[model samples]
Target chain A: MVSTVTTSLADVASSNAALRAFLHGLPGVDRVGADQRAAMLGTRSIKTTAKAQAIDLAISMVDLTTLEGADTPGKVRAMSTKAMHPGEGAPRVAAVCVYPDLVHVAVETLKGSGVKVASVSTAFPSGRSSLEVKVSDTALAVAAGADEIDMVIDRGAFLSGDYLKVYEEIVAVKAACGDAHLKVILETGELATYDNVRRASWLAMIAGGDFIKTSTGKVQPAATLPVTLIMLEAVRDFRATTGTQIGVKPAGGIRTTKDAIKMLVLVNETVGDDWLSPDWFRLGASTLLNDLLMQRQKLTTGRYAGPDYFTLD
Target chain B: MTRLSVRKTYKLYIGGAFPRSESGRSYVVASSKGEFVANAARASRKDARDAVSAARKAFAGWSGATPYNRGQILYRVAEMLEGRRAQFAEEIGGGKKAAAEQVDAAVDRLVWYAGWSDKIASVHGSANPVAGPYFNLSTPEPSGVVAVVAPSDPFLGLISVIAPVIVTGNTCVVVCSSPMAAITFGEVLATSDLPGGVVNLLTGFQKELVPGLAAHMDVNGLDLTGVDDPELALKAEQDAAENLKRVIRPVAEDWTAEPGLERMTRFLETKTVWHPVGI
Candidate 1:
């Protein structure tokens, strides 16, 4: 994936000051334009045959997530089972995201199904732990057979203008994740601005994250369209400059098939077809899968499906 | 300077909100003399789908409500209807006295059903004499969401069909033939203590809406009283079998007559409970 321009961007990581200069020198986001563009792209009405395809694509791109403190092994197993077979002939979800402790349960349940197990680590939802603890947390999930590690960024450090602290933590966690893919959760709700989301997206990609995620699903306003749009642009720009493509996962607030389709629209319009696959884009939601399944049933059966028919998570 | 008259557009009531039909279509609702009265929102099958969803969402809360509480809310709806008598009579478009009588009958019919909220269960339920060391009791339970087709009798027919469904703790999605009065009845329901989605009124043709509701798996019951067409009613009843929905057959009715316990019991399921004696 390395391009000739890789060395020029890699030099910025040599120092904290260089990284800050590059992140800050990137053009500031016009908040209004980003909002307007996201809203405009959202208005595209995908209907009939196109809608059916989009529903299946969105289902495949779902990282069926359960990040609650009360998530148990049984719950994880059930969720994993649902993730692998949402409905008859429906595409399996891209991954199943759980708290770090339940990684093995999901891994065991999803064996031979090809659905990746993603564990949120780094004292997830709030990256307030020491780097030693965070690295071990990633290592624990990796050892438990998690294929992906979703580590939260140090919001306290990032908010305090310590970009290097956040960058180094992501790097340490990435190193701990052996062969597993790394998804850096920005917790954009805490970041407070679009430019910061863009900067955090770049920082995670530069720090060797395989995917740049919007949130840990524990925060409010976890993933908004505009924030995701900004992240998509950052990934697009990163691939252009460094020739390395980073996946985008917008976790949390997306709870409906319509919201899932809107996220797809944002991806399709923002970075075009290259980022539309499950490998590049994922919706980190728990309830979104059932809605997609219901919609898929509606499309195939020509009637609306009830929540009663689908098993509750 | 003269002020512009604000025209009242008839809209659908779903989940307690007055929304224009998603289809963005309206039909000319005319008086008995065939003159156009107003344009009523012509709800499509999608609207039926939305109304069923709303009714389903409201089912848990409405059905869980105490029978006495439901009675109070139904009584409150009757009170609201009483106050709106003149508006409903004018909307129904008959002689003032006759229209007013129809509105009064609807109000009285609602009150009658409201009184049955706490008593209907007792009337329909029974204690079985089982030859075991246990007490076996059979009581009626609200059968989830109901989809109803209201008769063309603008006020009395609609109210008679709806009040019984809701008073029994069942939420309903209703397709009413008289658009103006149905939407206006929505206003009365909104002003009452009754919850928004407890009774969703869709102003559209029954032929267009019944099939969708019948096919809706979430809807537990269907009242086909308003569907005058035998073919449409048969098709809906057949489709309702997809989920084994309890269906009430179409029947001509005199709204002013005393209503039997049948309307209240039609959409109710008999839940039998067996308990050890003295436990």
Candidate 2:
């Protein structure tokens, strides 16, 4: 396989033709190999002290998301409070993710609490809106004091081999984010192939996204191990040539402590300690926090904790 | 050349699937005459934890099901067991006549419990006579996941303990000594309409398995009816007290005798609600 890690990030996005060539020219993902490696990594025990520490770290790395259409202001406030103080003596989550309209509630609730507020934009889960609308949607969230903007890429454009459109959209949304961090959601379930996931990861990073996320938690086959593995490989390779570190957030379907620990194992094995912190690696999920808290309680108290004690997401 | 006989491996049943112990350990089982019967999976604490997790996962769907629907499923389990009678009879292994009789009794016992599903509510629940302008009523709801320690009678005792717990919608993790018979019963339940995790059967040393379950904060009830050792039962009761678990003490009762409503009622919580009367 030829090395497709471009030395220069600027020239690749210069034109649609150049962006397409750069993406297509990137090496293909060995589908079977990635699946096998992820499965193997998942078998890691991570026992006792290591497990306790990983649970806390995974809890802190959670985005504490609730992106439903029925999300009320009260819901967002409750989620924000839960994110701040997950449980007694437990570390707070990294951020509270909601739709762009509710960013103010999350931001206001999370103020001075050090828990960042992330808002999903660009027509969210579908990304079917116009570029003007997408940019303004992102701007609205940023204006509402969102610390981060999670923007979805147009899969229709990307799958039709219009890599340039996807790349440019990320760039546009990144520009709209201002001082806030921009996380580009590939919605990898719709991406269809590991090869596309790799190319999309590079596209998001090159276009100045602070993090490349997996799914919107609205899609099935979301945030799988093999997909996250491919994205982690992309961010690792991107950081190698450019010396610019990008984050990876595997959202959705990661609802258990075991699944969360497996993600941490993948990060530790693939990218080492540099990306271990919440600023670098994150888990975007709603139901996952309670499981993490439950596991944490088990580690400390030596008895299995039930879902009854924890607040429902 | 004559074909070699394929012997079945007796495994633990958790979440409706036959999985070997997580510890990768198995123990030898002997017949009444002390002859080698089979190798049974010796479950560990992790396995117990997994069973509780599975039981907890199945709780909502099983509990929320309509009483009539649950009745049909329980009846379906009996139908499945009836077809597998000979196999269960052979595994029960006292004598041909005794084994057959026990399996029949088990089937009848199940059918007996199945009949109680829809009717139990009306009989146990009450319309309270309050001295005010309101309608007050009390009904029994399944008290979440319960852990069972099965008695040594194998087939009938296993059926009696499990049938009552599940018929009312409470899910369970059972520690039984008779591996072969329990696993066969597990197969019957799996193919039946009853959901997996509703009855997770673990065959192992009760000493190792009982304490963990008794102390589990997730398990809502503990049935120590099968514990013959007084000391072990006492320790489990103490651990159970940590979580305020509702427990049933052991009794030297005959399995063939008529079972009362107490077995089902013991693991149930009375939900009393008051609704305003019609204007």
Candidate 3:
């Protein structure tokens, strides 16, 4: 009988351990700190072609930031039409990220592009205005023609330990978006830590952010390995908890194939197979396209293409 | 000719104990003279956690203290700051005159917040009119543990953000600017007798410490008044939302231009009570 009891206890212990492990494996459904998330991402191997494919797919779906003050509403509409030409091999750009005022331009520009128009609101690079004005700015951007509103949170609020206010504002902004997607920019460069980055990512997701983007490209220390890792973990955890696959966008400083590949590796390792698709991933960069195109050409012909080979325009 | 020896090391301030950053990583601390002072610790999430725990533990006594009593303590802090005015002026970025003005402003703001502690309910609070003969009143209360990314520059920015939060009874885990003035502020906090954990100071990059506080579940709020980057501010705001914590965004106005009593008042939640009136 004693031996039988010991066997039963051992069985129970094994099952308990298994259960705990399974629970831990579930993606955390909340914002995680940058450092902790980075450590987890770092633990996994960077080798995975599947990860690279996911990143490629994500890049393809991006709304590519291509406005240079020359984007009139008509011009933007024309570009959107071309982007969504839907030829035999034509794929869609995820969304078109544009200046806050130009959101309507992109909206009218890609009215039928099937591509979402994302407007950079909240005073863009400097969120120094009053809350009333910021909220109004987001509302106006949404009303103008944006299918998605990219709103910058008040950094001052985040630094002051007034997180609820920030979260509430995002929620309000998300409500303001109506049917439009809400992509929240963390500007990871100014945030300074993988832990904070993870936290910011989680916060944005919970506050109804459709996508969590890194940096405005205007700040120093744009995007880094550790910061990206934290954001990926946040997405993974958010998906596991809510059964919702939130999107990830690493903006600023991502201008090369190598950088894109690294971020892809981070996402795949942290979030697993489900998130390896365009719907859940995106790249917010201006210069990254040329590098990616160059890499793609090299892969196809096994020869380095000169900068002129691809029309940068 | 005599050779001048240079020192390299940053010490962490915990419960009045000056130790190296627990991470064992030390970064350069430059002074106004362009000289390196000491290498400070690169505080980690663990250190931030410890600091938060310390602040949470200390909140009961600190927040529970009578408003008059709290005011006296703040007054004492002002007094001490006044005495050390010259030292702070020298350490803060602006020239002596500018720094002195900043110090004075900070002292005045501290006193201003101190006075508000006992009387905020009257100034910023109100009674609601109900359909029935019911009395409803709302008064502001502390939001508990706050994680602050202090200004990277110093003096006015730092004091402007930090004082308002604590004056209203919230304990703070502040990540002071990378170098210089932070150490001096730590000295000011050390001598203030404002309770051990009521204001825990961590000297490091705002980028490094903010994430730790943002992700910590125990932290009730975040203040990103010093972070200049719009994207980072948005991210920090987003992260704070994960836990539904209170967040205060950065404003463009000069913090020193006027007393930011509203900033402090904004962080407070008005808890209203209702009772039926009998004839």
Candidate 4:
């Protein structure tokens, strides 16, 4: 019996080492820097129509941001009101992302529209609050009619090699979300490394994040390809681990069709055909729509639609 | 020797006393010999709520203690468990070897987490590079009043789940395994000199008790690591959303599988402070 236990322990240790080696050797694309720029330039001329349609599909699927910092309740209400009906031909953005306290206004305004009201909770931009307050914030958001909650993980904990703490907090936040989808924001800029990003992504999924997001859009150096690549790999691994499909949202600084297609490619390559649909993928951007529309007109008419083809409401 | 059938009744361990299930309902727990032991109490939603209240009330002093002091107290629990190893071994049906290892691992894990009280912040924290020079340092903190579903399995698994939550200064209301192990462990908790509500144990069907705790608006977090069923874990996650409770989905490993420090830190929150650097 003693020998059996010893051998089992040894086997577990060796197998873990092999698995680590295998992960370390896997080819990872960095979608954040020069590599992403090259990829974007390479695909810039792929006949704007197909690309426009894809970008439109991605944008329509996304939940864009409208409120942040200390915007007044009235301004938030107005933003939601305008967001609901942006005139006749305007392609509607998916949803409005806001602070927890303002979730109800957006939810109330967007009622009957399929658009969701997502709230950034658990200390958005910087997750430097107590778990009690964070959980309360999340619960309060859900109660206030937040269709989704975007939570920031304790990057401090993750950096310290405390994967379990990061994982546990994501789980707790997911629980607090109830029916509302929980988007675990990695705040990739703070994560610093692709390896950390990959691990953080898996940790979030296992801990119950419905969607693993790229950034809160508040931080600098947001949304790069390498980071997105690592996250996409994480989503794929999570699917393999639990046989469940999780969503991915890359927010902050995504402003053009070129940017949108690269993310789509990363998702397509990493998770394959199943995740290409809107249900599994979303972009959180306020400016990517018009660029897509401009490119779409160029594709059909074979002439530049110029800068005025799209209007910002 | 004549065979004697000993009727086992599952009971509730509250405030250092083992009492009949307040609900007046008793369920039979079978021993390895296939004979029934004492009937244990099946705790109700009220009981879970009451447990949370007790734990919340106790949090101030428990979390306020110096890490070294908490470490010593946890070490004391280990000593108590070691002294009572024979009782656990016999009750849980594990022989001396399994029981000894379980007790040692639980004790070691407690010590490991106790040492982390003062040190975790330093190890898991840093100062960020902001656009402006500001005095900023991030430190890990405790998420309060956690409601944990103790591993449904006896002995080792139960200890694995409960120790990590408490070591981090978060008080817990634990629904322990349904069988005889909860009672035995409850005895250890009673004598461990742990504060009255610091570690509350409930022995009953986890499915019935978990929803109450998960949906409890006051409970800060839910660790559902013990619910093996994916459906139950999913339901617990959904229920936790009502109050936006922190939900920890079940990991595939056994309680003793990972180093307990990881679990301890997971229940912690990091507080980072930034002050402008314009001197």
Q: Which candidate, 1 or 2, would have the higher TM-score against the true structure?
A: 1
Tell me how candidate 2 scores on lDDT: 0.93
Ranking by lDDT: 2, 1, 4, 3
Worst 10 residues of 4 chain A by lDDT: A1-10
**Native interface contact recovery, model 2:** 0.67
Model 3 per-residue lDDT tens digits across residues A37-108: 655555554334554454456457555775465766665665556456422233566777777777766666
Which sections of candidate 3 miss by over 4 Å? A1-313, B1-10, B31-34
**Where is model 3 chain A poorest over a 10-residue stretch in terms of lDDT?**
A1-10
Q: How does residue A143 of candidate 3 score in lDDT?
A: 80
Predictions' DockQ, in order: 0.78, 0.75, 0.01, 0.00
Show where candidate 4 strays beyond 4 Å: A1-44, A81-91, A296-313, B1-279
TM-score: model 4 vs. ground truth:
0.46
How far out, in Å, is residue A46 in model 1? 1.3
Candidate 3 RMSD to the real structure: 22.1
DockQ ranking of the models: 1, 2, 3, 4
lDDT of each: 0.90, 0.93, 0.70, 0.73
Stretches of candidate 2 off by over 4 Å are A1-7, B127-136, B274-279
Candidate 2, residues A1-313: lDDT per residue as tens digits?
A: 3255545778988898988888888888999999999999999999999998999999999999998889999999999999999999999999999998999999888889999999999998899999999999999999999999999999999999888888888889899999999999999999899999999998999899999999988889899999999999988888887889999999999999999999999999999999999999999999999989988998888887777889998
CAPRI accuracy category, model 1: medium
Candidate 4 lDDT over A115-175, as tens digits, reads 7788999977799998888899999999999988999999998787665566667768888
Question: After best superposition, candidate 2 residue A21: deviation in angstroms?
Answer: 2.3
- Name the better of 2 and 3 by DockQ: 2
